[model samples]
Target: MKELQQLLKKFFGYSEFRPLQAEIIQHILQKKDALVLMPTGGGKSICYQLPAIYLPGITLVISPLIALMKDQVEGLIANGIPAASLNSMMSDSEQQQVKQLCIQGKIKLLYISPERVKAEADWFLPRLDISLIAIDEAHCVSHWGHDFRPEYTQLAILKERFSKVPVVALTATADKVTRTDIIEQLRLDNPQVFISSFDRPNLSLTVRRGLNKKEKIKSIVHFIRQHRDQSGIIYCMKRSDTEMLAEELSLFQIKATAYHAGLSPQKREQAQDDFIHDRVDVVCATVAFGMGIDKSNIRWVIHFNMPGSIENYYQEIGRAGRDGAKSDTLLFYSMSDLIVLRQFAEESGQVEINLEKLNRMQRYCETDICRRRILLSYFGEEVEKDCGNCDVCKNPPLRFDGSILVQKALSAVVRTQQQIGIEMLIHILRGAARAELTEKGYHLIKTYGAGRDLSYVEWKEYIYQMIQLGFLEIDYAHANRLKVTPLGTKVLYGKTTAQLTKYMPPEPEKKKTKASTGKKGFKAQPIRPIESESVDEVLWDALKQLRKQLADRESRPAYHIFTDDSLEDMVAQKPITLGDFNQIRGVGQIKLEKYGRVFVSLIRFVLKLPKLEG
Candidate 1:
């Protein structure tokens, strides 16, 4: 334990672990299977990483994303840990070398995709001294999860082959059902489950309903412009929509690129690289764009259209404000979006199950409470205080006692035998309709014009509120026909309280205000150029060339690993010791230990030159 603390301080420089990290680490050290349910940016990696550094044999980390694997491996190496990733990026020869290192116990950790683990053709397992297996994003194995991958089913086999070896499953999002699915599929026997709170206080959440597609696009652009030069993502429902939005953002002088599966592999790689390098400030993409994107400073995430599920919505928005810095999350919803999404669900051919899920999502969109509160509650966490950032908390709309409203609506549905749709029922209440209602002579009913005091829009809003409050529901297979649940029966009998907020549209965008730059007290440092052909410059250039060749061979953009600015900064700083490197910005203690030695060697060679520093 003392040695672990000393190593933690020496490498990562952290004094202690975040909540549950130590417990999870201890569980692994004790050789126990565990499941960790941490929120995004809750230090999920440290739980496995700390254990890997101290344990004998290589810790095999199964991850779904190659980019995430590379970033983490680079981070580990920076911290002076011998970590390597065996992904598609490596050539056959390079892969063989990595496998050899793992077998020889030179590498502390080995990161691979689950698909590679399942592929019997891979010789990674045969050669390595495998200790512990850590599954990052383990929720992908469950069908109930948002991003389910078929290959994850084979991960359970690791338990059989390496029976005594411990397996640790980690994920950022999972509810009760999904958690059960994970335990059942992986056969985790009473694993030590650690679940954390989902609230992210620094993120301000808001939902705006757009009248049409153009207005929706304008709203998204407006939000992005408000937070200019900041990192963000704009999610669209379709690939074509992503392209159109990216083009529009570019025309507005916003730095953005499009990413979707439809794009060529090279283009998608370039787009991700550009975003990570800070060359592009925004990425307009479909749902596939950010599965495991680890760039931490994203300031905002805008959903151009409503998402398919609340779980997906929360996970996507959770990507923002990851740095624990203040950020914004915006969602655009329209009544028509329900129809479009319903049609899409039908086309997927999982008509019964998918439609049921979409119906729940629709009610979530129409809910009038604090949006964040509803979302968190679905994840099995409760927030007693209303979040001040959501639409309901900011400039709250008026709430007429919905008790009477619910009774009337439910009575009308029950009186009419619940056969008609909302349009006919609403028409009966309003006492106004076109020739179709007149032909049915529905106006003769005693409930006719019962709600005539309220306008058509007001009645429609009330029905939506009722649906959200669980008084009414849609029979998905029956052409989405409206029906009252048992809860509706109780509401009609005045057995329940229905408190609903009337939806009020958002105000016009506020005028832009100029922000004051940080020119007070602190002054900007001037850059001094060194003379040409310094020995340090030669080594820096050599490293850059090596990176470029590796990036090219792997079909990845070079700057993803080290930005040009970061490289230049390293050259300028020429840190001679780990301490010196740690003191520099962007040179976190881990990074200094990983790549610092080679750069320090180059600096020492330069300082020995007669024409240079001396």
Candidate 2:
């Protein structure tokens, strides 16, 4: 433990491990297989890394994202830990150099893609000490997991090849079913599982129904403009949608770029690079973009089109506010998005979704209940009362008696032979004389004139609710027609009664408000530069060396222990004692207790001082 402490101080410039990190490290040191589910920025990497330094063999880290792997490797090198990644970017000689380092036991950790495991096992697994195998983003191994990668399935071979080596699997998101699948498929031998809560209070979630395509585009532009100079992403469903939205945002002179599979690799890389370096304010992209990106300042994630599942929704939104800074997640939903999503779901090749998941998603989309409450409840997390951040909470739309309207819509679908879509049904209800209505048969149906009392918009909203209530199904490719599913048939036959909620718009905000568009918390604190650099260049290089050593030993993110913020503050204040270190803002109690002593000691050594003045 003393050795670990010294190493932590020497490498990461920290005095101790984060919460639960020490326990997790001990398990790996004892050769116990562990499965860790930690939130983003929770120090998951350090769990296996700290042990890797102490153990006799080289530690193998299996990672999925090339960007994440590259970023992590850079941090490790900065901290003086001999770490190298074998990814697509490396040349043959570079790969050979890294392999030689591993073979010579000079590398503490070897990061490789899951796809490399089976193919490279014979080459490296035979010669390396192999103290432990750590699977980063372990959720990808599960079939039910949202970010399922085909390459992840090959990870199971780790247990088969290195049975005695301890295996640690880690991820930021995974529910019960996904958890079970990870354990079974990874072939773990009774792994110790750690599941962390998925609550991010700093992020506010909001879902708004699009008035129309043009209105939806306008809202996206408005939000990007609202958070000017902050980096963000706009997710679209189609490649064409991505191109058009990028074009529109560019027209408004927002530094926007488009990313899709359709783009050339060089263009895609350039766009990603631009977004990361702040050359572009926003990257309007398809679902393929922005996974495993490490840029810490993304302020918002806007979905111009709704994602297919709740899992995808949560993950995309999870990308924002990663710096523990306040962030916003805005989703633009419409009846058309629902129709398209449902049609895709119905046609989806996955057999496990069944009818239950379909109904649940529909209810979530149209529910008059609190949007955040509905979202959290879907994730099996509880949120009491309404979250005032959403459209439904901000502007509570009026609720008229929709029981009559629901009955009329369902009756019309049953009478019209469920193939007719929303527009035809709405026309028939509003008593509009369309040629298709006359061609279909008699415009004299009893249910046709029954809904004549409701306006076209009002009646369409009712149909949307009925669909949400499972009494109607809108098939988009089938001419955007409505089909009465078995459930709808039962409701029409009076075998079951539909309890449909009214569709309401968001409520307006109250009068009292902040005058500035800047974030509420986290005042604009001046960031201090490295003390040694400003004071004496030689001393600054010494401090950097010390930080590299500490980062290597602690195996924690260099940024986490003392963010560039804390480092700057350290140089500015030059605290010479634990108590003095506590004076800095943002140094919370947990951090002060764990790291105060080391930072103070470093300061005293550098300045040739005794105790701190304060």
Candidate 3:
């Protein structure tokens, strides 16, 4: 423990370990396997990094991205630790040098992609001495995980080859099923599992549904404008959308850039570098952007289109408040997005699983309960209190007795013998005289046209809600026929009651009032709130400018020198001397020796500090 603390302070420049970093590191040192389930920005890198410092031969980290490897390797090198990466991005000669370093016991940590590891097995077979194997993004090994990769399934080879070596698998996103799949696929030998809380209180979460593209762009522009000069990312669902939206933001006079896999590696690197250097205020990108970004002051994240799964959504939003600073996230959703995702799922081999996960994502957007609660619940975590920061918590939807509506749908399903799709069910309820219904029924069923008061779209929304609320299940193997669950059976037989959020129409309301489903058509409710607390704007701006100047001089990202959180702490504390500055969170001995005096002077100038402060 003492050696770990001394190493942490000397190399990482931190005084203490986050939640379970120390425990995981010690477990690895004792040669025990561990499976770590932490949230993104939960200091996952340190769990393996600290172990590498103490482990004997070498710690080989299997990362998923070249950019992720480069970012981590550069940070380690900057701290005077011996780290190197072997990827396709490096020249043959460069790769040979790193391999030599590994053999010579000079490289304590090595980063390689799964593909590189697979390709270089011949080279590693004869002579590779590894003390620890860390699988970053271990969730990819599972087909059920949000970002499933077939390449990761091959990672079990490491365990098969080195049966005696202890392994540590880590990921930021995974539910119970995903966790189990990861463990089985990676072939961990009864690894110790560490699951942390999924709650991220620093992020204010909100979702806006049923919006057109115009409204979505308008809302996103407004959100970006609110954060003015801070760095933020706008995630779109496609490369084309990223390019178009980036152009749109540029027309609006916001400094923005587009990032996607379609771009050449050079262009993508430039975009990432510019964003990191604060030359770009907004990055309109696809999933390719945030996975590798280490920037710490991203004040906002906006999903221009809905993500395909809850896991993807959470991981993307997790990128926003990494520094534990106040941040905002807005997700725009519509039924069109759902249709698009369904098409994708239909084409996928795992149609059943993909559709189920997509259903959960849709439920989250349409839910009237607290958004955070639904998100946490998806990860198997329960929250009993309103998070107060999300859209639903601030302006909750009105709940009403939905027994009549539910009973009508269930009766229609029963009359149809429980073997019908949503469209057929809706048609039967609305008394639509289609050829199929007419030929089959002879207009004799008593429950026909019981839902005539509801439109096609309204009935569809209600059926989807009932499915999500656990009253009904879809039999995918049986042509997606509707099947009643125990809850649905009770509700249908009058043994139980149901409550739901009253639907809202698209038309404008005459006045602002809570929506009530009292025999009137539902009207849409608009919700938005100004939730950010006021900070020291003058000091914030001055400190940012100074940091940028220092970054420009050092040719590095501003956050690399001193993060925004650290600068904010400096301003708030008004540190005057070396000792006072040393007490700041991100300040370390190396930074204090190289750049601390300059930052201290800047802080003194900004605060008009006295020669000494008691």
Candidate 4:
């Protein structure tokens, strides 16, 4: 175990493991199967990568993204570890060379896609002395996952073929249903499962509702301009939207590009390569664009349109600030987006699940409470108080004595027999005299016309809040009926009272400024350098610049080479010797042997530290 810790410091530049990583590695080293649910950029790769180095024989990693595989392999090789990848993009000679390396016991880790694993397993399995099987993006195996792949469903063969070999499955995002499905689908044998916190404190969450196209585009442009030297992505709903938005950004001289499944393979590859190499400033793309991208320096992510689910939104927004630096995400939503997304769900053949997910996403966009709390709650994690970083916590809405309005809404539901949908109940509450309503005699009810002062949109928002607060329930499968829950009944009978935010009004256009243009209806806070009591801010920035320079020289993403957290550790410790450097959190042995002297000398020179006598 001490040797493993030393290896972590020597090779990966980390003195300790992230939460659950060391335990999972220890479990795997003990030949136990495991499942890990850490967020993206949570160091899931290290959990398996480090164990693969120490475990006898090669560990075969099953991943879905070729680009991700390439990035991992490059980083491993840069760290002086023997790693190789086999994908369709490799030439026959390249593939044969990789195979020879594996047969010669020169490669410690081999990354291959699930489809390649199935196609080549027959010939490939026997060539190497396999010790462990590590599966990345394991959520894809579950049919309920947002990124389901049929090929991933066939990965059960890994455990079936190698009955004794321990398998570890991992993913960044999975709800309870998806987690159970992945466990069953992968057929793990009593694997230890670890779920880390879903909260991303470095990511500032913001949401805007009903932004017109012009405003959204302007807002996106302002965001890009604010971070012009940095990288960002604008995610749209449609391919055409990507192209159009890319053009709009280009018109503003932002040097933007578009990427989607609609683009040709060559074009997509070019865009990805350019973005990775920092040739492109921004990418206006659809949700399909980010899953395979490994660039870690992305400064922000802006959703030009509403996504289908909170899972997708969280995963997409995770692309930003992967280095543990402060980053921002802006989501623009509208009612028409909800309608279109619902229609898409109806056409998807899995209507109930899709609609349920979509409805949750809509509620998230419309919620008046703490955004982070609601998001964490959806994934079964609970935070005690509001995350002050979000817009709601930053600028609270006007809360009124809404008990009367709540009683009216709930009472109208009962008076209408609790048999109708929200629209009908809303109509009755507003005292609508439509022909059907008149024939049904809904106007005669005492609660009829009770909410006449509120508009249709206001009533809808109120209903949404009621549902979120557990005051009401939607029988989604049964004509989408509105039913009063126990909480609603209490409110109706005066046993409970409620205070709700007033109806949302149209937001005035904000005057664009350096720090205020990233999000609509809100201003983005100035991104400050990482700070701690033990370190100087200017020195920390210098260390980051040094890390960036090293990363550029190696042609790797900055974080993949050395994370911002690692740099912060260096700045804090101010180590001037290899021994002292190894004491830093992320300073592994390989990094110390490779670039330790340069960093140590830089620190000594900058801080005027005296050299120790040999």
Candidate 5:
């Protein structure tokens, strides 16, 4: 255990294990199967990577994307760890070289995709002395998971092929159902399940309701301007939306690029590379763009549309604030987006499950309660108090005794035999003289026209609230009809009351300038560096510049060289000697030997201090 900690500091440069990382690593070191559920940036990699170094044999990592594998391998090698990747992007000779390195026991860790493993496992498994297997993105194996892939199911063969080897399946987001499915599908043998708290306090969550296209663009522009010189990602629903949004951002002189599967492989790779290198400030992309990204300095994430599920939203937002710094996440929600997502869910093969997940995501967007509480609750983690960081907690909305209104809606559903959806129910409540209502005799119900004082949009909002409150549910299997839950029955019978937030329509977005022009009309604004009270601004800027130079010279991401957190540590500690430099967080032995003196010299030069011997 002491050696493990030493190796952790020597290789990964961390003095302590994050949460359950140490326990998970120790269990794996004992040659046992385990299931790990930790949030992004929670040090999941270290659990398997560290054990591989001590286990005396190579650890095989099954990853989902080539870019992800590449990033991990690059970061490992930069830390002076023996790591290599085999992917379709590599040539035959390159693949052969990596295989030979593995056979000769020169490489301690080997990363390959599930598809590659499926094709080569039969001939490949027998050649290497396998110590352990690490399955990343393990949620993809479960049909109940958000991002299910058929290829992941084939991985069950690993336990069968290597009966004595330990396997660890790790993921950032998975519900109870998905976790169970993963264990079953992967055939893990009595695996120890370790679930870390699914809380990312550094990320501030906000949802903007009812924004028009122009208003959303304006909001995005304003946000980017405020967070100038910081890296961000704007996620769109479609490929076309990515391109259009990228162009819109560029019109304001923001260094933005478009990324999606529709683009050529080279173009996608270039976009990713530029973003990782800080040559691009933002990447407007579809969901496909960020799954494999490992950049640690993303200061914000913007959702251009509602995601299909909370899992997807959580995973995407997890990309930001990875360095555990303060970051922001903004999501724009509109009725049209909800409608589109519902249609997609209905069209899916798993209609009931998908719609249920989509409804939860909708509730997340519409709820006036703490967003973080809702997010944590979805992952089965109980929080007694609201997270003070979310917009709802920061600025709470007005609430009123809405028991009468709830009874009115529930009574109408009962009068109509619960045969109506949200739209139809709203129409009936608002006394709309529609032909379908007249044909269905809904206008004559006793509760009909009871909610006529409220506008159509207000009623819609309230109904959605009721759905989120568990008083009502949408049955996707039944023509998308609304059904009263047992909770709703209580409300109808006056057994319990409910509190509802007052519906406030979005204010009109003030147009400051033309869509194609900047805020000052054509002249682009200069990006201001982020400010911190504790950090010395001048030294921080210098360290970033030096890090970027080293990154470009080595052809690696700036964060790969030294994350922003490390830079801040340097600014605070102002280490002047090699010994002091080694004390900085993330400064491993190899890094201290490789780039230690240069950083020490920069610190001394920037602070105008006299040079000192070690």
Candidate 6:
């Protein structure tokens, strides 16, 4: 463990390990199978990368995307680690060079796609001295996961071929079901599981509801103006939406671009490249744009429409604040978006699970409780207190004892034999005289007319709350019927009570003022950059510019040189000597010897400090 810590500082320059990284690394070093579930930016890569450096032979990393592999390899190389990636994009000669390096034991880490492993593992495994196997994005292997890929199923061959080699599987998003599936599919031999806390305190979560298209556009533009000169991503649901939003944002003098699978490969690559290089400040893209993006300086992420599942939403939001700096995430959703997403889920092959996930996501957007609490609970983690960083915590809603209301709804579902969906259930409670109610004999249920005093919209809101609070469950497989969970049964039987939020009508949209559309636009409005109070703004900007210059010279992303967190550390510390600079979070011995002097000199110049003696 002591040697591991030294290697960590020597290579990655971290003084201490994150929560489970050290334990996970130790397990891997013992040549045991492990499954790790850590949030994005929680340093999952180090669990495998650092151990690979210490292990005698090269490590095989099966990744999902070419761009992701390339980004990681570049970052590793920048840290003076010997790493290479083999993908379809590389020439035959390039692939052969990486292979030769592996044979000659020159490469410490080698990345390849699951498809590559499926195609050539038989030929590839026999020639190399393999010490470890790391599967990234391991959630893709599960059919229940948000991003299921058929190619990943072929990875079961690894355990069969390399029975003696230890395997480590890692992902940013996975519920219990997906975690189990990953183990079963990969045939890992009783792998030790490590689940890090899913909390990201540095991110502020907000959801804007009841906004129309024009209103959403205006809100987004206002947000961008406040966060100008920082990198952000606006996720749209469609390719056309991306292009239209990009064009609209550009009209406001924002540096924005569009990215989607519909565009030519070259165009998509160029757009991604420009964003990574800091030549563009925003990218209006679909879900396809961000899966492979490893940019650590993304200051914010905006969702133009609600994502279909909580897993997808969590993963997308995880892309922001990777550097552990304070970042903002805004989600704008409306009923139309939910309707469209529900239709898509209904049409998909996995109708039941997809609808279940979609319903959960809708609950996330509509919940009046702590948003972070809901997210964490969905992943099987329980928290005692509400997170004060979300919109709900900042602006709490009114709550009332609605145990009777919940009993009324649950009784209605029971009277209807749990065979009705939400709409029918609501109608029965409100005593609506529909022919189906009459034919089904639901209008005569004891709970009928019990909730008639509440309006249709009010009843709808309460029932939805009941579903979200786990007082009721939606049986999507059985015609979207409502069933009482064990918790719901407790309320139905009067064993417990329920507290529900008071139904609040949506506020009417305010009339637009001239300033909203003035020629000078939002650009002329002054807004402070979203950053910590202690960080030196001017010095931060200067360091960013310097990092960009260095990245341009090396043709790599600015973060490959130093993450925003590292730069902020430097700014706060105002290091003027080589030793002081080396204390920065990301300044390893290699980086210290490579670019420490220039950075130290710049810091001295910027802070007006004395020059170091020769």
Q: What is the lDDT of residue 260 in candidate 6?
A: 96
What TM-score does prediction 4 earn? 0.79
**Candidate 5 residue spans exceeding 4 A from truth:** 400-535, 612-614
Candidate 1 vs 5: which has more TM-score: 5
Assess the local accuracy of residue 115 in candidate 4 as a C-alpha lDDT between 0 and 100. Answer: 90
Error of 4 at 209 (Å): 0.6
- Identify the leading candidate in terms of lDDT: 5
lDDT of 6 at 236: 92
Indicate whether candidate 3 or candidate 5 has the larger TM-score: 5
lDDT of 5 at 228: 69
lDDT of 2 by residue, 470-551 (tens): 7776666678778877877676666766665455543333332223232222112221223322353323334334543454
Q: Please, what is the TM-score per model? A: 0.74, 0.74, 0.79, 0.79, 0.83, 0.81
Kindly list the per-residue Cα lDDT of model 5 for residues 344-364, writing each as its tens digit.
Answer: 988899999999999899889
The residue-by-residue lDDT of candidate 4 on 1-614, one tens digit each, is 79888788667776677788888889999998998988877888888998999998999999898888988888788777899999999999999999998988999999999999888878877778999999998989988999999999899988888889999999889999998899899899998889888888888988976566887887777666656467888899889999998888878888789999989999998888878766677898987788887677788899988999988998999888876778889999875577678879999968999999998998889877899998899989998889998888877889887888889988888887887777788798788878877788888989889889988768877876787678888775667788999988888889978988876554544554433222221112222333333335545555655665676677776666566667767877888888898777656667777777777766775665876445
User: Measured by C-alpha RMSD in angstroms, how accurate is candidate 4?
Assistant: 7.1
Relative to the true structure, how large is the alpha-carbon lDDT of every model? 0.75, 0.73, 0.82, 0.81, 0.89, 0.88
Give lDDT tens digits, candidate 6, residues 61-99.
999999899889998998889999999999999989899
Q: Kindly report which residue pairs in candidate 1 clash with one another.
A: 77-594, 78-590, 78-594, 79-590
* Candidate 2 Cα errors over 4 Å, as ranges: 1-20, 53-57, 343-349, 354-359, 370-400, 404-420, 424-460, 470-480, 483-614
* Each candidate's clash count: 4, 16, 3, 12, 0, 0
Q: How does model 3 score by TM-score?
A: 0.79
Per-residue CA lDDT of model 1 for 71-157, tens digit only, reads 778767755789998889889999989888877899998999988887633455856677888999988999888778899988888
lDDT of 1 at 178: 88
Root-mean-square deviation per candidate:
8.6, 8.1, 8.9, 7.1, 5.9, 7.3
